[model samples]
Target: MHRLLLPIDALVTLFVLTAVWLGVSSSYDPALSYPVQLGVIVSGGVYLAVAHGLVTWRIAYVFGRLLLLASTAAAAVFILQFAYQDYVEVPAIIERIGSLTTLLPNLNLAWQHPNAEAAFMIGTIPLGVVLIVTSRRWLWRSLWIVCTLVCLYALLLTFSRGAMVGLGATLCIAGLVLSKKLIVRVGAVALLIGGIAAVALTSAGSAWVLSRWDLYRNSLYVAGDYVLTGIGLGDTFPLVYSRYGLLIQVPQLTYPHNLLLSVWMGQGLPGLVIFLLLIITFYLFVRRVLRSQPRRLFHAGWLGVTAILIHGLFDSRQYIEVLWLMGHLFALIGLTAACGRLALWQPEEDVPKVFRRYFPNRLVAATAIAAVIAVILFNQELLAAWHTNQGALAETHAELNPTLRAADREAGFRQAQSLYQQALAINPVWPNANRRMGNLYVKAEDFAQAVPLLEQAYRAEPANIATIKGLALAYMWNGQLEGAAEGFNLLPDPARMAEELLTWGYWRTNEQDQPLLGAYAYETSQLMLPGNVSIPVWQAAADAYRAAGELERARQWYERILAEAPDNTAARQALAELDDA
Candidate 1:
């Protein structure tokens, strides 16, 4: 049991350290809340603990066999769903092509992302390979073969282009490692080349492949810019990409897509080095174990890890379920290798007498007690913040329902407000609680109450667009025209400014502020809605200028509208009225 726990201890220590560093250094992304991060940590801990227990109790072999059976059954279900969707639900080839434009349908498998499902299936390929190689019975071999084929088919259905590349590369490498004959190696190479060619030659495949290439090139540029201290963990790629990714016309992305680059960009050079070192150490240990033990299961797990790592080269999977699964497999392999080692008791005689005299059990006990107390103190605030976020999400869902009854909607808002207050009572400056509460008030059209809450949120996350928009609107509705305009000016894009102006334009009651708002709106419109302004937008702009007694500017806009639509009665009347003025 001690030998089994050794590898897990090392792994847990490393993971805990990494998690701690990330939590401390990561830039706070509202999308990646503290509750989510805490949940991931808890889940990973549970997985590791369970995996360690299975290995220590010598039940890992049975567990692995059962897992393979379950996975194969799931793969069959996935394949049937795919076939049903493709053949019966939407048979047309053109419709399938259209579906690929969005997300590739998951066939009702609970894995939300197709790429994640594909990665899991691809990782299973090595297990099938190991079973086929090790099983002496014909029935077992045939079952493994069927499982492998099904997984391969399911992988293709996922349409995860990067996973496809990784799978091909992994299979080719496995073939070379497992096959001793030169002829077999040659066949493996040929199959790899042929498969890649087949995929790349297809029109959709070509587009997918080329787009990744563009993204990869852009990622290199990002890596170069932050080659030293990185942008910090959990920092959205858009934070840097907005400035650097324009050349590639890269859409808004959450991550770098490449696992290694993601680490480099998030945690800096030191963190990247540490991550690579961990991988290298694990690989070396696996290789050493395989040499001594020559176990088929160990070989399979090593191959699976290799495949996932290859996949990670082209896609980010570090924070997902794949990583946890990989960690479990690594622990099992490590435990198998360490099983021959003697327990720590056997080494006690070799310890120095002076060191042996001082037992650290008391110190350990005191440390444990302190840690428990700290956690108990911290958990109260964390729970409050988590509940507050949940309430906010509930409110958002209620607000989204256009057909919701007034009573139910009000109840949701009230519940959300209560939750936010609870969170504030625990931690007054809790990150998003104030902002969410403020937005709730804004939705209710209670601008006076919203202004102070929004101001607090704005102070907390000054760069957040939602906070800026909410505060600006709150100010506008509360009759603070100058403050609203100032908040609108904080936006980076002219188009966004124009759009927001249109949203809150009706609130401009101040005569003094009308000409300023009108002039800014019209100027931004020229850049945004070139060639022809929509009638409503033009009329709104004309009305603002007219309210400000700026007939000349209003007349010019009216003339422009008339140019687009010569028969426009409103524009003609407005121009005539301006002329009379």
Candidate 2:
């Protein structure tokens, strides 16, 4: 049972789980909270395994190798993130490393990766690497390659173009590397590449792929601007996407299309240097292993790691459990090699000699484990401070997001106002919070409070249609006719502004171009209430048209009301009264 658990890539699987948890733990969503907790339990198990003299065991070295590989991969990811800071949006490194509460349910869903599902993809990396390493025999190798193909196929489901490209390249490289003969290698590579190209041509050729090229070029140009130093990782992706691909709403967003630039943006030159060095170390280690002992285990691990490195260039699987697991598998391969060289106990030294050979390492591991506990505690304190007032605030604001939409539908002006206040207490300058608050005030006929917040939001974001609309609505509600006109004119389309002005103009000038205003009102009423406009809105609009002397248009609207409710006194009386006028 123990053997079954140990060599079957269980350790790597657990490590990937740890990374996944790290990613998941970053989200504060209630839906992901439970999954985060499970991730925590998994991480704890791995930690426990390390504490229980596992690190010193033969398998312990495997764990260490994986840890080292993971650290290296993380460093690589960080470097790429900084390099393409203009395109890729990286989260806080602390968040990437994860938190204790990462085990909470649905916590990580908030983290939207620009390219792919980071946590899920990262999880696959380690698992893939481990599978490759363990599958060196002919059958196992074939199975492993097939597994990799399947994984990449699954990656397409993520709709991450970068991941797809990277996976394709990695597979191509793998076919070449794993080929037993030159002829087979050449044939396989050609066959696969040609097959893929044919499929791409048949489906859509380069049209789908080329459309996003400008974004990539822009990202490269922006990354080059930073040169030796770049913007922080977390800031880059959002900035790039907002600028280049705002119009294109695809699953693989326009972000730091290149991972190398992302890391450069975050940690700058030193980070880049560290990242490059880590990659070099992996290459050197692989070279050394292949030269000294070209075992199948080593070969598989090396190729797997290479694939991840290739993939990391354009995609970030840092948050994925499988990626981390694969990294650990490579580490395990290296560790097994290292331990074979150390030859600490010769399998004959019993448990005491085993203790003698590995006790010092165990002591250090124990000490480090204790320090980690202290750090966790310290982090918990910091998190508490950050959320001291924030938790209540989040709750307040959280209620508003969904509630405002409902309020808008029902025209529940008062309820909307309360929700906006609740949201403001949580986050005063929250964009939607301010907008919704103003809208609510407009609905309640409270123009005074509505104007200031609406203006604030509009100034901050002039292109925001909702803000402009709210501001104009407030002016209209307050009887500030000219102010309403000015506000309406600010809209990009004059025709829309003219139509709006016609309605309010009718209310102001009782007989000025009444026909035009009435026509506009009738058209608007038709659009707003396809079936009928019996609501107060139609009544007011009709009155505005009548005041503007648009007799025909007013008659049309009044006739509409009477059509809906034949015996409705107001409609009948209004129609008769219009005739008298």
Q: Which candidate is the best by TM-score?
A: 1
lDDT (10s digit) by residue, model 2, range 1-581: 12212312333444334334322222223233244334434543443344333434345435534453444344333323322223232335433433321333342223334344432343344445555666448775565455444444334333455555555565666567665788878876886688568536864546545544544554543333233333333323353333222211222352354445544433343445444544443444344335444434344445545545555565553323323332342443444334332332244545444333322345446657986996687654333323322332232223322434654534444444555565566555554556556765664557788888877767755655456666766665554545555665565564554545445545534554444444343344235323544445556566666765766767876787677667768767878987897
Writing each residue's lDDT as its tens digit, candidate 1 over 1-581 gives 34323443455445445545553244324343243334435644554554355533235445555556666765666555453344332226534643443333455545335556666776667777777887789998898888888787667666666787887887888678777899989989998899788768988778877767766765654454344444444544554554333211234776677778866765555557556655654554454444454556656666766777778777765544434443433443343333322112244454333222233335446767986886698876556656665564456435533466889888877887888888878878764677777777876778899899889978876765556767876776665756766776665454666574664454442443645454444444444445645777776767677777777777877887888889999889988877686
Off by over 4 Å in 1: 1-12, 24-61, 76-112, 187-202, 210-273, 286-293, 316-551
Write down the lDDT of every candidate, Cα atoms only. 0.60, 0.46
- How does model 2 score by TM-score? 0.37
- Report the Cα lDDT for candidate 2: 0.46
Tell me each candidate's TM-score.
0.56, 0.37
Off by over 4 Å in 2: 1-136, 153-162, 166-445, 462-576
Residue 389 miss distance in model 2 (angstroms): 8.6
